[model samples]
Target: MNVGIETGPVRTGGYASSPERSGLAKFVSDTSAVFVREILLLLRDPMTLIFSLLQPLVFLALFGPLLTGALGQGSTAETLQWFVPGVIVMISLFGTSMTGSNLLYELMTGSYERILATPLSRSSLLVGRALKEFAPLVVQGLLIVVLCVPFGFILHPLHLLAGLVVLGIFGIGVGALSCALALAAQNREWLFWTVQQTVLFPLLILSGMMLPLDTGPGWMRTVALFNPLTYIVDLERALLGGSFTDPDVLQGVAAAVATCAVGLVVGIRRTRRTA
Candidate 1:
């Protein structure tokens, strides 16, 4: 039986479907409405969006010329081919890692509880947030890649697709994990950051975002082998060079999928329980 109500939406205007709507249809509508709301909230203060890009931009400005030039041995093109993808990942890392703070803020302000009272599936809320992050990150990654063109960075169609795919997987996983952490921690802000910084910095460094690992110490390379970001970075470099059939790319994609799936499931489960 189609069990949706024909009632007015308490929030997310007109999001609630008619009373006769199917479960799947209602869920889709709710998720979409939630996604729109999230986007609108993000857009309301465009400065936030600009600031979000600031860190990566600063990193690129301060570090790009020096490191990329040195790394590529004066070949600016090769430098960007290595640097751009790492910048993308670094952006995702900073942006999504702190999503839990938003949730915590909502919870403290009673907004989250009100949202919980809505008839929409809790997973829709979580998924909507994930989609929100995914969209911008993709655009940001693309824009950065495009802007690098004048500097001699070459772009491949397949590389762009694969890079976006990898970043989407990374964003969703990180976003889901953020949500789960927020739910679990509730109002404990410090705990979230403590764990986040500990985990995040290691991943970023292990990824060798600023330096090539090929000449690094044996043990460091061995340690990086265990990090999923390392493989993703490897795939990005491969894609930058217009090669996609490498085994490492496949491994990286598989790792990304697994990580995203698991985090989403865990987050969805936690949100359901909270509801």
Candidate 2:
């Protein structure tokens, strides 16, 4: 006779125990789901992306000639070679920096709260939304580049690719920071727009995205040094110019990485607490 031993019952169908996903796997899955949802929304309402191109196009057409005339040294193509990179940066900045508004709208409509009720990690929510900005930014950048090519702007495939990578990295940070700001101003939407516009223009001008800082006053030059966008603009110029060995590239990479780190940290923390 054997000692009495009981066997456990096996669960069936949906009640069966399955292997739990690892942390990394779960995060990736959740992020992808959120990203796909965002893409769907973008496809449904594409006007925002289309309208975003207008400002950059206007700048390229109207201001580009003026820039060449003012400089009085370079050909139109040479001016565009320098100018187009800044325009790409502008595309990234304008496109990504305002992404928080969508989040803010969702918050007001309670859609975001519904999403928050899901099991998705807060980090994934922020990250997925930030990743959505990359598509539109890349599209705008490419369109601008292609449009400029006929005007004498040289096109280097590798350099443009590298520049897009930098722009994508920088856009991630700006977008995350924007979402964090939206969370902060969830109740006061005007404050979000006010702060965004107030800060964005100064950064744009100070970075010499439209005009060179060489002729600017010393104080303007000093302030530009502190703006992360300045490095990005410079780095884009260097890369497009085929100055592969330029030190600004390193500086730009460092700046973009730092911005991404800071933005993600702040966005995730705020979302965790607020949502």
Candidate 3:
């Protein structure tokens, strides 16, 4: 009776009382740590920086001139205008694909399990890894833009911003898909090599990396419609001073959204099992 009388009202925190809150907080902190680690790792690998800068520059110098005659006068100038955006997208794809390699490496070394053993949420790990991949691409894109200024390419600020956003979104979607595929792959190294030829090359061709869709065959044009990279290229073209119809732009946005959604679902499921 005395013990029962000693008992009083017990109160708890409101929304903050939810178990998810602590998990979310831990996830945020862990995600930040992951991002920082990724950046530092990239910094240590000087080759990544060299290649990232050189690839676009080489493409601009080589293909930029070759395609000049085919695109015609004003169009040639306009096509040349696409160099920066194209390079930006290219870097985004390449850089983001590396995320898969990182994930695969983690899986191979059991680092993924270590991370999952912590309180971090799955979303945080996935997103933080994706963003870490994207950050370098952004820096490379800006560097390419800076280089373009000396070449007489006047990039509108809004256009530049829009192009970066598109590239970032596209990169995240593609990177996630690549990561998921890699995770599911029995032989990750072999799969990584094949992805370049299979996934990346098609995206480049369908996206008009070398030539405009108008210059391609009717069937190729139809195929391009289905390629998500086409939208990225179209969005880049629009950002770089070419005409882009509302419907076409909308299609591109849809493709990017769809790719990202599917990839995310697959990646999350795969990671959960592996993690």
Candidate 4:
């Protein structure tokens, strides 16, 4: 959670020389530096690093087999096809959904303001953090897919790649929104936590990350149709399972684009204001 911590040292004495760079070059350099810094911080804590990835493995270990058995006369292949997609989506969502708390910590410590005082662009700052969060989320997601390989899950190469991109879009959206929430409720920990808890579970349910909507009650199915995440999950499952037909994948792409687009707008505006 070292959102603004430096991973290296710098010398700025009377004898230290400053190097000149072009605008685009400087922008890329700064963004990449922040991105790497966030990554180093993420891996610095052994416990947090492990926990960020362990949930999907836990679910894969604890539920993969059980889900295979519980799919109601469904074959092993069918179970994996159905289960792996949801698990992948869950990995991406849960891995970085709570990153807002890290932002809050930085705010309280004044690290956020310190970073803002620097020359780094606010968009770069937001993108760096989002990309950092996306790194583990994507890794965890692929790990989930790999773990499911033994559980009768089959991978379609192109579809898997497409699914990963969709998962990335979803993670970026969630991470951006998380940052917005943290910035909005900078001093209101209770409200922040409450809002996070309140929105997260319902969204999880609506996304059908743990259970298929088809098997759920009629009301839940109806409600899930409205959730953009529902389309995301549906597309991932379809692609992973090699059932890519009709409008599911297209709908998912559209939804993911829309969600992330909104996230970028809101995140950029809020981040500038917060800074």
1-275 per-residue lDDT for model 4 (tens digits): 76896544343321111256547776676668678878888878656657866876777667767876667737766777887788777777776678788889998998888787766777877777777776776667677777767757787878888788877887777888888989999988887789988987798888887776778889998999889889988898888877668488999989888888888788889988876
Question: Best-fitting candidate, measured by lDDT?
Answer: 2
Model 3: per-residue Cα lDDT over 1-275, one tens digit each: 46655333322211112343566576676578667767787889868767767877898878777766776735544556865566677787767776687777877887776776655567767767766766776678888878777766776777677667767776777777777777777355786768656777777778776767786789999998787787776777676663445465666667767877877777778777766
**Candidate structures ordered by lDDT, highest first:** 2, 1, 4, 3
lDDT of 4: 0.77
- What TM-score, computed on C-alpha atoms, does each candidate reach? 0.90, 0.92, 0.83, 0.85
lDDT of 2 by residue, 1-275 (tens): 77886455333321222247548987887788888899999999998898788998899889988998887747999889889999989989988999999998999999888787776778999999998888888788888889888877888888888888988989999999999999999989999999999999999999999999999999999999999999999999999888778999999999999999999999999989996
* Local distance difference test, each candidate: 0.81, 0.88, 0.70, 0.77
Clash number for every model?
Answer: 0, 0, 0, 0
User: Which tens-of-lDDT digit does each residue in 206-269 have in candidate 1?
Assistant: 8888788888889989999888888877777777778889786888787788878987899899
Candidates by TM-score, descending order: 2, 1, 4, 3
Candidate 4 is scored at a TM of: 0.85
Candidate 2 Cα misplacement greater than 4 A, ranges: 1-19
